[model samples]
Target: MTQTVSSTDPPTPSSTRPITRPTVVGAWHDRFEEILTPEALDFLARLDNAAAGRRADLLAARRARAHRIRHGEDLDFLPGTGSIRRDPSWQVAPPAPGLTRRRVEMTGPVTRRMTINALNSGADVWMADFEDATAPAWQTVIDGQLNLLDAIRDRIEFTDDSGREYRVVEASQRPTIVVRPRGWRLCEKHLTIDGRPMSASLVDFGLFFFHNARELIARGAGPYCYLPKLESHLEARLWNDVFVQAQALLGIPQGTIRATVLIETLPAAFEMDEILYELRDHSAGLNAGRWDYLFSRIKTFAQRGPEFVLPERAELTMTIPTMRAYTDLLVATCHRRGAHAIGGMAAFVPSKADPQAAERALTKMRADKDREAADGFDGSWAAHPALVPTCRDAFEAVLQGRPDQRDRQRDRQGDGVAVTATDLIGTPTTTPPWITLTGLRTNVSVSLRYLTAWVSGQGAVAIDSLMEDAATVEISRAQVWQWLHHRVRLAEGLVVTRDLVTELMDHEVELLHAQATDDRDHRHVDEARDVFVETALGEELPAFFTPYAYVRYLVDRPLQPAQRPTAEDLRRSEVVRGHEVRSEP
Candidate 1:
């Protein structure tokens, strides 16, 4: 049954709240709040204006076109009041546990080849994503999600290693499929079909996500989606309400629809439990998205150019700490909720473009797989099928207990789960890892923290004896964990604590202490803030925000916006000089 939402979720009535709230949308809802830097303030202000301005412009254009096309005929422009779009958030929702069923993740490059390839990947689910990997083009956004769905369940075809195309009968049984719809701002203008812009409310996008999800459901899957970048629980709740409305319209069951959100933003992180709780009946649990989360952190505190400035993709992928935290947190959060906490992606997928680099990448995969298995991740994803064998082999090998086979279990409990204090450096265990884990509930979070803090700059202190800044604590601590005090069964949940970090690095306590303080220098923070301000005000912003805005800036024509505080020109805000925006009816 779908639960009722509580007041904690922060749902909005249509007239009272704007679609996006800057502070709420930007950060996690933590109890602690900090003053924003002037640059940060400027960036936040622009983000608000940029998202709203583009939305309003798109809305106004629709209204003018509606006036001409129908010659002022009455229209059902907005959905009826008290409909999902206008429901009281909490009143319509209630909390529940173990709301989501099984989950499957989908990811590939944003090429047409990849999109289709992802659809047939041997995963339990698929999400033809528009959020992270896709270049933000509106046509691509529409075409990608709104592809022509054949009525009959078409047999999926793929080329195998031998270059032979075979039909996928039972081989391609994906239980779920979804598309991350475009966000409600500049991207909306780009999805414009014909001469008119797609509305800010994304009436069309909503229909697309709804229609496609239903078709997938009709194909023996369920109505499911992994929603991304949800800044608040209410956002999750809001999506739930939308799903309810769509279901009602489509004649589907009210509670059959489901969503999972990535708690990437700071505010969302703080309010995570609440948000997840609000939509618990329909929520599929949360994901700890690292790159976007870090990017969001920068964006929340710094100026527009600097805040939005991200390190090269390579840096993000290689950041062991970030990846570890994300994977650990996801596993913990999901297991606590009885939902599966899937691990992070394998960033080092080998590319034929660089053979030497590809070989090195394979070596890293071997190391990463060892760590991931050691950390107790149930499953992980890869960008390529070539990496599939590697992933499968790693998961298989860990269960089989290849390396670190020494030491009998030390301390063990909680439903027969065993965790040893003595390290298993090099003893070949006769027992199967799964056999050892029978009836066991392992917390991946607990198992991972001891390792992650080492990589994350948590314990990168100066070495007194080595007399260099290069190394510190985590190395020795990890050696003991990897080779010795083999923590096998009882997996730690993904809740961060200073004790966990310090205790995990117990043997190298002093060295780890020094390494943890290494990031006291804020040079990168300074560089990020400076770059943001410079780029945001540059000529490229109009184009960057929306292709329509870019085109308009060149042609120099006025466009009417549907809502307030719009038009960067303050003078125009006081008058109705620009063209008006509205509906298609």
Candidate 2:
């Protein structure tokens, strides 16, 4: 059942030396050979050999820092990097082509349909998210690369089960593409190097950069990227080095790869200036990754005290004092250094079933985008195409034909944005008794349904009109753990305990079954429940639920050749690229 794809390697100069090829442990899908070519695999192997050790060291440093924080070490700005912050003369590199006017960027997974829809959404930039918005099934990983390649060449198309067609707009009309690879902590278990799993970050970035860097440059856009889950400036330094080596090895000009780091972690927020300094030569800007920021806040200080107990996820918004402080500091820091300060995702998806509810959601979304535009943010993100115009209009009102507002020096003009370390970490700003029965139920319902869909290969699920991704799910589960750890009692006089959570989860599962129209919905509910109990109800709070759940549930064996089909594999058949095939027969 072992299948290997063969294709000619890209022509290498005679001066180049051979590289050890990384083993492809995943199954081969149709036309996957186009992307997993010999030269491409070699490129990934070389990049891994160069930076994998540094990546591992930084991840270990992250764990050590988290351990220290939980054991009573206070989190604050680094005293060592004060010189980088105080020095006013440094600035990030100017924006590359297709990145300067990112006023209404659309964010979605790189699925074929979603990819075409996002590029044609009329947004200034389309972030093809391979992290939160994508469930990293092996087929999904390879298929996404193929879709990107086809889209860039203007040959991508989609026909649904009913034969309805989907096509991308002309190349001139499409939004600029920016890829968000997997974070440093995750591993591409299917791709091994020296008998160890390759860093998923490098696997994703290396594959895309090797195949598309030249084509994208010829199209007037370079290999732009968005780095996620960065915990420190050192992580940024590692990525910068990777970019440098990537461009040099490929013979593309240095500084052609521009990256926007997501300042989602609490430690990253403190080291913003130093991070920009580290990647300043190839920096696009920083994003106010609000959802993961909240998750980080809870995870970092959950064991310390009851003071860090967070309210419900819905109750924590951009208006909260701490969140406001985070955004203000981000905008100020980015604007101070002449980088585009992009805002966070607007997760509302216009409800097709209810017009009134849709109107309300749009109104809320508009207000959020308007506030961000007023706060000196150059642009923001929308989860759906319908929400793009709202985001665009809000920024347009302030931009008035200007590409960005990076010229506004919000850091120098006001004390309102003068955020301190205490302002960033001081939580429960509102009154106590924040946890409500509705909040607890909402968390349970979201956890069950989202995880169900996630295990079934859908990373971005629409739950109660919001586009729920890994970041939002992380926030939900983290809140549950924080509440349980603090013994939080709702206003209804019900204490959050293992028994109560189990009861609620059972009830939610019943409701999900009743609402299920087919077996697809029921197929993964039990697995999702197992994941929820393990991650949310455990004694120790796990930093993320994805790594554990992914390894346990989503990893599958490679597909057999098309001609060989066993009865077991036939029972587990799936529709891949319009063909009904047994994945592991």
TM-score on alpha carbons, each prediction: 0.50, 0.91
The TM-score obtained by model 1 is: 0.50
Q: Candidate 1: which stretches are off by over 4 Å?
A: 1-104, 109-112, 146-148, 155-175, 184-187, 190-205, 303-327, 353-356, 369-378, 396-585
lDDT of 1 by residue, 1-585 (tens): 111234443433322222221221122222212222333233323333322333444334333433332232222212222133223232212212222222225554233445445555655445555554443333334344333232114533446678866443353353245445544332233322222343323332354434455555555555555576565444555566566555655677776666667665544544444555556667655655554555444333222222122222224442344344444444443444444344555545455667887777777876766666555554455555456557656666765642221111211223233212111011223431221111111111211222233122221111211111111111221211221122222223222232333343342333334445445323322222222222222222211122222222211123323332223431122121133333221
| RMSD after Cα superposition, model 1 | 19.9
* Per-model C-alpha RMSD: 19.9, 9.0
lDDT of 2 at 78: 82
* Candidate 1 lDDT (Cα, 0 to 1): 0.38
Winning candidate number (TM-score):
2
Taking the tens digit of each residue's C-alpha lDDT, what string does model 2 give over 32-71? 8998899999888788766765565566567667877788
